[model samples]
Structure formats: structure tokens, C-alpha cells
Target: MQQYNPDFDYKSAAEEVLAIEIAGLKQLSQHFDTHFVQACQTILNTTGKVVVMGMGKSGHIGKKIAATLASTGTSSFFVHPGEAAHGDLGMIDSNDVVLAISNSGESGEILGLFPVLKRQQVTIISMTGNPSSNMGKLADLHLCIKVPKEACPIELAPTASTTATLVMGDALAMALMRARGFSAEDFALSHPGGALGRKLLLKISDIMHSGTQLPKVTADAPLTEALLEMSEKGLGMTAIVDADNAVIGIFTDGDLRRLLSKRVDIHDTTIGEVMGPNPQVAHSNMLAVDGLNQMQERSISALLIVDDGQLVGALNMHDMLRAGVM
Candidate 1:
């Protein structure tokens, strides 16, 4: 008999599932030995894409694994077994490698499509719990992801097994990525809309203000005139440049307040006299996230972009903030 309580025992239920899945993953570590290396070598050596296919929960995991592989330098895509029967198998090239995922290693839909893939001489990689199953036996390389039991209390749901399979798939993707020397820039290119992409792909030139938009004035200009440029531009600061348009100084809103504290008259002072000399500058080629770092470190909100010592552009924290780089 069980007593009903207002507090459902979700914590214990979740913890038990996690504990079982963690153990299942640990068991999978042994399978990542020589067989795993051979599978990766086969995929990397071939000049072809990877085709990941499965059904049900395994299909979901296979889709994500395929995506991870694609984004990390390997060309790959997911194919539903049912879709393959309906004609999506045309996406697979003769040179492509087929990666089939099945916890039981006996999915009828996958096995039914195997003959055609085999006839085309496509290299096959199988991930399954049973080594003797038809899918495992027909593969060129096999990864065993056997689990002791399901984490589900009824021992019917695919919890621990699916988690183990997904982790193993990720391990394979990353292993191939590192083996091929895939760099951060490569990863950034495949994920240009995400955080790492913005950090690595967005250059200072892409977001900086230039031409008439740059807040700047000559050294001989009056402080009052520089103030007008700063206000017109609305960046709260103006760069003081020389005849060659090389940035020489910067006058910020904070600096204006400091001058006011000294009782200096803006109308009488020259821009050069009030500006901070040789202020820090950035290059347009530098990454925008790095520019954000420099700004934070210097306790400033904007930076001047100079190329070969000539002022080319300017940027503020607002630009980076709007770009979502921060």
C-alpha cells in the first residue's frame, strides 16, 4: 500500500533515473577503444558525408548527433527510416558512410533499407546494444552501447540506453573533430547565429561607425565644437585627430565633467588641451568581443578604430550590446 501526499516524490524519481544513466554512460567508456578509433578513421578518411538514421527515441538522438557532426566539420545529415523507404535515401551518395542507430540492433525499418545501402557499397557504421543483431552483424564497423537495464521503473522505456547512445555519438563527433584539427573559426562558421559564432566571427569593422557617423574633431577645434560633435553623434565622446586623420586624443562625457570641476571654460579651451592624449585604439580586423573586453578593462564605453595609425572608425558599447555580442 502507498500513502498519498501533496508533495509528489519527483526528486527521488529523477535522481534514480540520473544515477542509472550515469552508470550506463560509464559502461559505454570501454566501447570507445579500438573499435571506436576504427569507425572514426573510416569516416574521416572517406571524402563523403555521414548519413545517420534510426527510428523512435534513437532517431531523435541520431538527428542531434548528425547535427553536431555537421557543425563540427563533418558533413552529415539525419534520415528517418520511414522516409528512406519513401525515397529520401536518394540524399545518400555512393561515397557516403551510413551510420545506423538502434538500441535493439534489430529495427525492421532500418534492416529493410540495409540491402540497397549495402549493394551501393556504402560503408556502414552501426550503434546497437546487441552485437549479434542483424544491424550489428551487417555493419562495416560497430559501436556497442549495451546497458545493464533500463532506468525506467517498469524496465520498458528507453532512458539509460538512449542517454548512453547520445553520449557515445557526441564522443565520436568530437573525436573526429579534434582528429581533423577543426579550429574555432570553422566551428564559428557553422554556427554564425550563436554565442561562440558572434565571439569569433563578428569583426570590429562589421559594426563600427565610420564616415560622418564617427564622432571626431581636429586638435585645433574648440572644446565647445567637440562637445557639439559628441552630442550630435550621441556616443558621449569625440576623437581628436590630426591633419592625417590619425587619432591623437579622446574627450569623453566624464572628461567634460572633470573639466567643469576644474572651472575651465569650454569656449576658451582648445580640444587638444582638454583631450586625453594617445587614447587606446582598436583595429577593425579585431573581433568585436575582444573590443568589448578592452572597453570593460579600460572602464570606457567606446573605442576608436585605427588602421596603420589612421583613424578609420569608432564603436561604442551600445553597438556591441545591440549586436548581442555582450
Candidate 2:
């Protein structure tokens, strides 16, 4: 029977595992050389996708590697080696590059697809701990992910080696990202459903309230009228525009509170008398993130969008939050 100890040093064991994995990653870094460069060149030159394949634990890591590569501008997908041997080999084309993973470089399922890949004229890049093994020998290029030891206490499970392999895959993906000049905008394009996509791809014009939705009161309008526009628009603010529809000032809830504190008559005062002059403004094309930064830096909650020196639209902190640009 297996023994259980309630006093086991769980924290120490976890720390030891982390230390071993860190050491393995450091060792893996030392193997980056001409082979790494050649692998990158081969993937970059391929006209088709990078088909990643592996078995067991390596297959799990291969799926993640393929995902990272795909998101970072390297077109790629993961294919289980076992499935590939049974008619899934049709997914690979002569123009595609294959990235196969195996710690021993001799996984039977992966090895079985070698002749088919070779016959299809597909370029093969192998990642393994043993460069002398069959998969490495048959590959057009080989990447070494050898580690000094496994983090598992029994030295049988794949722990440190898998960590090192993941780090190597990340390195390759980032190298390809840099070489392809993949910008944050490009990344946002690939991830359009997330907050990052909103931050990078959303512009001021896309979310700012304009035209009939805009809260506006001429600079000569009475403070009561401005307050009415603010309440009707529900933006907590109103733009004080001049005869040419240019924003000369802005009247917000903060200004109204200050005006009330001064015992001023809302019915008697014009918006120009109580409005904030030269309020912070944004251009229609400005990124919503930049607009948010401007609002944060100035300690203000609202911004007027201007185009060619004319008030075009307006939005406040609440709008930014609602649009997911906050």
C-alpha cells in the first residue's frame, strides 16, 4: 500500500519543482544556434500553414504551441500524430511545414507519418531531447529541448522537460512575430472579441455619441437650458458651443455643483458664465485608449470630440466603461 503523510513538506516540494523547471529552461536557452535560425527560415518561407504533430504529453504541448504560433502571426494548427496516420494525413500539403514533438524523438505514431510526409514533399522540423533518434535524423531541421533532469520525484514523469519544450516554443513564436512585424493592431484583428481588441481596435468615432445624441447648449443659452440638455441626453454634461458650432466651454455635473455652492440662480445665469473654459478635447480618429488616458491624466470625466475645430461628438467616462474601453 502507498503511504500518506499529513506532515509532508508540500511548499518545499513545490518550490523544488519550480527551481528544477527554471534550471531546465536556462539549459534549454544554451542550445539556440544555427539550427534554430534554419527552423525559423523554413517556417517563414513556407507558403502553407505549419502543421504541428505529437503524441501523449508532447501532443498537449504541441496544441498550445500551435495556438500561440497562430495568434502571433505564424499560421499553424495542431494535428495528433495517431490521427494523421489514419487518413488525417490529407490535411498536410506539399507547401506546408511540419513541426513534430517527441522527447525521445522516436514516438511510434509520429515516426509512422515520416514516410508519408516525405513523399508529400513537406518540410519537417523536429523538437526532441535526443537528436540521434529517428525523428530527428529524418527531419529537415531539429530543435533540442534536452533538460538535465525531470522535476518529478520518481524521475519518470515529464515535468521539467515539458516546461523547457513550452519555453522553446514560445521563443520560436516570438521570434517569428518580431520578424513578421506583427503589431498590436494585427493582434487585435485576430482577437476581436476580447477587451484587448476593444482597446486596440476601437476608435473615438466608433463609440462617441454624435449628432442627435450629443448634449449641446449654445454658450449664450441659460444655465437652466444647459441643465435640461444634460438631463435629456443623460451624459452628465453639455457642450457650450459658439455660433459656428465650435466648443468654447463645457458644463458638467461638477460645474453645476460648484455653481449651486455659489448660490447662483440657474434661471438667471448663461452657460458661458458657469462653464469650464478650454476643456480637454479629442479628435474623432483618436484611439479610445488614448482618450481614456487623457481623461485620467486631466482628472476629468468627459471629453468633446472635435473635427476641423468643430464639435463633432462627445462622450464621458461612463460611455468609455460601457464600450469596454475603460
Error of 1 at 298 (Å): 2.7
lDDT of 2 at 258: 85
The sequence of per-residue lDDT tens digits that candidate 2 reaches over residues 42-83 is 898889999999888899999999999999999999998888
lDDT (Cα, tens digit) per residue for candidate 1, span 182-201: 99888888888877788999
What CA RMSD would candidate 1 show? 2.3
Using Cα atoms with residue i matched to residue i, what is each candidate's TM-score against the true structure? 0.92, 0.96
Whole-model lDDT, model 1: 0.92
Worst 10 residues of 1 by lDDT: 188-197
Model 2 regions lying over 4 Å from their true place: none
Error of 1 at 191 (Å): 3.0
Q: What is the C-alpha RMSD of each candidate to the true structure, in Å?
A: 2.3, 1.4
Deviation in angstroms for 15 in model 1? 1.5
